[model samples]
Target: MSRFVDIRIDPAIVRRAARGDARAHEIIYRAFSAPVYSIGLRFTRVPAHAEDLTQETFVEVMRSIGSFRGEAPLGSWIRRIAISKALMLLRSAWQSRGQQLDEGWEDFTPQRGQDGNAAPDATIDLDSALAQLPPVGRTVVWLHDVEGFTHREIAALMGKTESFSKSQLSRAYQRLRPMLQVDEEELADSKTTAGTVLGSC
Candidate 1:
C-alpha cells in the first residue's frame, strides 16, 4: 500500500457514514472530492470521464463503508476505491476498442534521449508532461511512482505480468525523462505540492 500523508478524519464521521447517514456521506464527499477527481483526471484525461469516475467511486465507497474496519485512514480507503473504479473504466474502454493490454509495446519503444519535443524552458510542469504520454505508459508511471504500487501490485491490477508492468514503467520513464528534467529541489517541490493538495482533502 502507498504511504499517504496522515490526515485524520474523525472516527465518528466514519461511523455515521457506515450507518448510512446521508449527511455523513455528504461530508465525506466534500473531504475527498478533490483528490478523487484529480486521480480520475490523471488516468482518463477527460473532464467528463473523470467526473463520472469520481461519482462512481463515491457510490462504491458509500455502499461498502460498513466493511471499513478503520485499519487505515478514510482518505486512503476512498483512494483505493477511486483507483479501482478508474482502472475498470480504462479496461472497459480498451475492450470496447478491441485493444489487448499488451498489444502495443512496439509503438512505445523509447527513442533514446528523445525529449518529447518539450519546450526550451528551464522547468517543465510534470503533470503536463504526463498528460502527453501514451495512456498505458502514463498509467503505469502514475501507479508505480505516484501511487507507490509495486510492480507486482500493478500487474495484478492491470491483469498483466510483472514483466509487462516493469517494461511499461521503463518506457514511461524514457518518455518522461526529457520532458521533465527538473532538479532535486524542483522534484521535491512538486511532491510536496501534490501531497499538500491531496492531503488537504
Candidate 2:
C-alpha cells in the first residue's frame, strides 16, 4: 500500500515496512542512520544534537515511508528530512536563544590547551578551521561543499536567493583561507625573531 519508492529500495520491502514489518523498518534505519547523523553533526556541531536529529529523522521516515513515490534515492529522501530538521533546530536556537551567527573574528581565536600552551597543530586542520566560521557561513559551506547541495537547492532550503547562498559560501571561504593557510608576514616575522635569537646566542 506504500507509494513507489527509490532506487535504494525494493518496493516489497517498503510495503512490508509500511505494513508493520519490524525487520524491514530496522533494515532501513540501520542503512541510513550514519549519513543522517553525519549531516546532523556538521550542521549542529554537537554530538547530542546529531544523535537527536538521527532519531527524529528516522521517526519521520518510518511514519511517511509509504509516500516515498520513488522521486529520488531513498537515501536522498532521508537526507532531505535530516537537513530540514537540522535547519529547523538552527532557526529555533537562533530565535529563542538569540544565538549570534556573525560573531567577531576576535572571539573565535584558538584557545590554549589545559596546560596553557598553544593549541595543538590540529587547530589548523580543516575541521577546526570550518568550526571557526560563523554559523550562517559554516552552514552554507558545509551544505554546498560537503553535502554537494547546489546553490539553488541551498537557497530554496534556507528561503533565500541563490545569490545569498553563493555569497555566504564565498564569505566562508574567505574567512577560512587565513585560518587554514600560513601567513607570509607572520612567517617572515618568526624567521626574523629566530635569527635575532641565534645571533644573541
Q: Which candidate ranks first by TM-score, i.e. highest? A: 1
Residues 106-127 of candidate 2: C-alpha lDDT, one tens digit per residue: 4555445676654456323556
lDDT of each: 0.73, 0.68
lDDT string, candidate 1, 1-201, tens digits: 233335567889999999999999998888888788988888899999999999999999999999999887787788888988888998888788898765555555433234555565423355656666677877887777667678998998888899999998767665656655654454434254333332233
Q: What is the alpha-carbon lDDT of model 2 when measured against the actual structure?
A: 0.68
Among all candidates shown, the one with the greatest lDDT: 1
* Displacement of the residue 101 alpha carbon in candidate 2, Å: 6.1
Alpha-carbon runs more than 4 Å astray in model 1: 1-5, 104-117, 181-201
Clashing residue pairs, backbone N/CA/C < 3 A, model 1? none
TM-score, one value per model: 0.80, 0.75
